[model samples]
Target: ADAQITSAKIISLDAGKITTGSLDAARISAGSLTADKLAANTITADSGVIADAAITSAKIASLDASKITAGILDAARIDVGSITVDKLHALAKNLVNNYSRTSDLTGWTATDGSIVTDATLSAPVHRVTTTTNRQILSDYFEVDPSKTYKVTLSIKCDSADGTRYFGLHAIDKDGTSISVIPFTVSSRTFGGASSNFYFWSKGGATGGWLNLEAYILGRYIDNQSDVPEGKVVTSHCRMPANCHRIRLRYLNYGTAGTARTSDHFSPTVTAVDSGAIRAENVIAGLLQSVTGNSWISLDNGQFSFGNGALAWNGSSLSAQGTFEAVSGTYLAKLDAGAVKLSNSGVELGYFSIQTAGPTGPWITAAAGASKINLAKLVGTGLYTAYQIDWGTTGGTSATHRFWGTVTLNENALYSGAIDCGAIAADGVVSCWRVEPHLDNNDRCGTTTKRWQAVHALEGYFNKLTIGSNTCWAAGSMSLTTASWASVSFGKTFPSAPRVFGQYTHDFTGDIGMLKIRNITTTGFQATIGGSGFSGIAANWFAILV
Candidate 1:
């Protein structure tokens, strides 16, 4: 009906209800409808009143998200699983690479029997199934120092003991642990039936170990903590300060009693959580501890390792504690002024410098600071068989001074008169230096033995050659008549020997004389001085000056 009539005025409207298109949308004001104009609960939603696909996205421009003010949209109105990840715009993303089981986990480094295994775990996991201490360290990731970050690790351990756990640490550019950085355990959810929410943290002495330890505590059993097998633990950490980089450590330590397996799953490290990172291991703690004047300092502007134990710093370097090499087998310990070296915890020997001697410097070594039975050899005989025979007289065996008959090859100095048993000679007997001061006055030996040694006939009766001549020699030879006679000697000298001989006959008044003329190394020549004499003998002698 295009027109309606009012009963009172007989107009063209009957309360505007009988008219079609009487109140057009273009002519109607927005929000002009009043509930009083209609009966309460009059209009109902049905196929007759509303058509299908009537309420489209374009039609909902009146009730869009911009129009959602002063109240929250009921989540119940949205179907389950209708809101997807793509629907949420600019959500905080995980900073960790391969957080899901999307890759082989190349972002982690395995240490000590840790590996990437795809076994019974639902996804390929970073795992360790060793009897030794096993760990896997994640690769260093860049982080923001301003915004707070949260790291989540999904780990499964065969041991519920707290010893098997994971840790979070911040490192520098050189991969060294940074001190004075603090973090918090934001949240954690345990999976196993026997999982405990308790954790333990140890502020290490050097600020390098056990910074933040999130572990799986065992269920109580008889006042002792017992482990549950195949437990899964999830930990979320929020760090306040990360100057350079961050790494995660998942470890299985002290699992000796039983074999243990640890598995890691989908993890995340996002900067969604907000908080201020506080200080923990500050350098002031370390600087305050560097007390006393005996600090580690540079000496002589140079540093060098002296021997295998001590390090030379200018003049000296005193080591405070035991210094172990890269391999634990080699160790150097300092006790007093000596440095003891060892291999595999066995004290081998030590090197010490004798500082109290009159000499300048000496390197002294001792054997384990104890008297141990050891073997030594002298020549072809052992030291035991070559014991010195101390020839004692006034004292007992223990108190006797060494006057033994033993022969030693060492340089010795004696302070008493020597009573020789025998001075055996197997080679040439030659005397070099002989200083005879027999008298109380240190002048010389008495004239008797002094002259006797110089002109001894029987003691030293050998030919002495002085450059080109011999000392002295004498003998008797026979000479006859007017013939030239030769004086024969027992042996020849190294040089031409001097000969002086006078012929003396046994016959009375035999006037023949022998005169020596030429001398040679072999022999000497002599001729008769008297004429025509026979049957006579002469005595001859030879000497060299």
Candidate 2:
């Protein structure tokens, strides 16, 4: 009748029905009650619990400060969030090996000077009793060539001596001084004057040593008051690179017997935190020659050289094998040392080549309204096509325009179509050919005569007469008596002219019948004798065929 449990039999019990007293410890097998089989909040200290060593992170659901005892969690067991910048900085390693002078001067070397531990100053001091300058160098050190380092040092003068010059020098592997930062002290005061000096240098193979030097002046002491007591003086130098050595040097420039002292030489070398290695495709050195298609762009400008092509910034776009415009079109090109402009592209209208000789420029143009128009456009107005100007001086304002052919060498004007209002020539003879024709005159019963009028120096006349001998004659003569007078008509009529006539104004009588006796082409004779004619003046006559 009682509830019976069998081996391998599964039974479900009420939440509060099961009790520890109901089960026997000897009958319960080891590891028989799993975590899931246990009821919540059932396992307390008063009841029963697992062993302390048996409880792990997997066994514990969560934990708080109250659950964890003090000093139980170490740095490894603590969360990283609990750590702070101050703690990390406290644990940082100093890159400087001998930052403090507490140790002996084992890694330092003094040139022309001696470095000794001074008990009075509680630091290492470098002393130079000689008038000559001395230097102290440190042991060998290494540096990353691509890194930048800051070197700092402190200098203090124990005795007020002559003017002193101290400097920090960076020495290359070949013992060449690459850089120096100098500190000058004009005069040292009685009390020690300490100065903190700092310098920067980019690390490389050549920059292997950091050195310190001092120059002591001699013989120029005006008084003992100006001289400084030589005792414990110190210098401290610090740099980021693993340096070869620190050097302390003394320079004697003046009289002898001048002593110098320096102490507390501590140096700090720190590397600058530049986030990442900046690598660039920069052309190093003085690029004498470049061979492939490579471009480097910086700021707003771009430079490229390759395949016989070059470009500068964005002003030029195309770079096949030469310089070109943005549209892949060439305006000019340089090939094999010769420069040429495009002929089929944009045309250059006018060009000029000036040289020492008589060679001229070669200009070519396409077929069209191609021409070279030279003009000075002052304002909006029409201008003449061609204007030839002449002047005796620079300011002479005389110009001539020719619409037809004008030969400059021969001084000739062809086409014979001159619109000159008046003409003045310096020739011995000036000729004019005129077509004999009247306006609106028909050829019917009208003579269309053609003649050439010539003016010679012998006379001036408005009308010309040509005789059968081809002699030209023109004149107006006056007669005084009826005697036969030689009449000068410039040229005589041929056969005394079959028709002759005479007219007189001063004579009132018949003027007698005028007669022509001599008949020649060069000259003629005329006589007037009828009654009542005493003299004749202003006589006009003509002998016509």
Candidate 3:
């Protein structure tokens, strides 16, 4: 009853006529309230004038953390690198080396192309402009089938065509290869590369080509600390159970059967949850199992393999093959029976090489059980140049030693005892002192074995070439029942030699006189006019004139 005026009488109420505290927000009409009509400082959050849903981020130009209340911020709203690797998944490591090559291709091979490099590049850029289909291969290394591997590479194509391929080959223990998975040129996802691009492996079947997208790992980035290059391509591979060794390969096909100019950069291979790889190290047990020419172990330490077997045991060394020492035309080797030295095809068993420490290897006469014995091998027969006389007078032709031109540089000394054997010297025999002269003693050298060791002395029928008409070459031959036969002059004469012919008969009738002709430096001709002269023998001598 105080006002009793309801209805249309209150249609024009002036703000000056009503008290400020009398009207509340709910009493006003809902559609009539607008942002521009609101008075500054008139509405407070505590006054319940503005609803929470009515204010949005679009409505606020500036915001402070103190102004934010009651809700958590989304992860997308957080800054980058705010987290660390302790917050990420582990068990992954880079398996391939030299992928980001600053210099050489240590673990990679330019199988079909040459290595290309640049100064400004952080990695190598192998260009494939040389071959129509260029290929690159990684080191053939051991891998475990339980692990999953990833191969990533970034490529820039200057000129492109045809198709590019990535392949994974599985190798057996014997080095046999198996194609586990392949991205061949016959089947590829992308067309001829004409521009620079970034590729990806965004969730696909195993061995299938990855889908291409403009965005990379960050496309679905959830963690602030997770960062990766956007352009590098990645492919997945699982080592087959049949595989023993793993090898990664890439093949680049060109455009229109012509090689394209493309640069491949930072090709990498990675493995997840891989424990360790079996590699060669200090152990020789496994290496010894390998047959063909490999480093092996000995009793003392280690050594490499050669053609022969060698062993060293502290102070002693054992060699199996021929212990040979050859210089100029002189050869000295240790045989099964004796130690021998040969000069100008004249072999003598009298010396051996002994290792005397600091003095190195020196030639010494074989002593102890290795007694010096002169022996020579002819075909399947062994000939002893010196032999002991069986208590006989005349020396047998079996023990008749043959002598040739021997140039003795110095005196030949004899200190050790020598058995009863002959030494035939045809040329100059120069010596200091030679004892055990069998020419005087019957128990020592036989009469046929020993010589009356002379000094500056000329004896016997040795071709000495005394002066005019002296031929220093002598040999004997017979032409008994034939027309003609040849005989050697023993030494090449300076010219044709003068001949002296003599005939002898062993009680039988004498044959025709022997004739000599066709004189050459190496040999001369001996002929006979008569036949059936078997009973006669001719003793001819040629003297150089």
Count of clashing residue pairs in every prediction: 8, 44, 1
Candidate 3 structure, TM-score to reference: 0.24
- Between candidates 1 and 2, the TM-score winner: 1
lDDT of 2 by residue, 294-366 (tens): 5555555566667426666667654454443333553555333333454456533223352225666633221
lDDT value for model 2:
0.42
TM-score of each: 0.24, 0.21, 0.24
Task: Output the lDDT of residue 57, model 1.
Answer: 75
Best by lDDT: 3
Cα lDDT tens digits, model 3, 1-545, are 78789867777866787665666778899798788987898999888988889999798999787977799979998789987654532212234544345444556674444567644464456656644556677777676555544456655554424556554566667887654432111222223311122133222122322321111111122232222222234322233455677665565655556656555566655543222233342443534535655454534455544533664444566677677789988887776434677766665334334444654344333221222335688999976654432223232323333333323465443233322233334454443333223323343323444445433212222322323232445445667555567777666677887655544333332234457888777777776655565434555556554
* Model 3 global lDDT (CA atoms, 0 to 1): 0.49
Residues 336-355, candidate 1: write the lDDT tens digits: 66667666665655656644
lDDT of each: 0.46, 0.42, 0.49
Which ten-residue region of model 3 has the weakest summed lDDT?
A: 211-220
Off by over 4 Å in 1: 1-93, 110-121, 160-162, 173-175, 180-242, 275-545
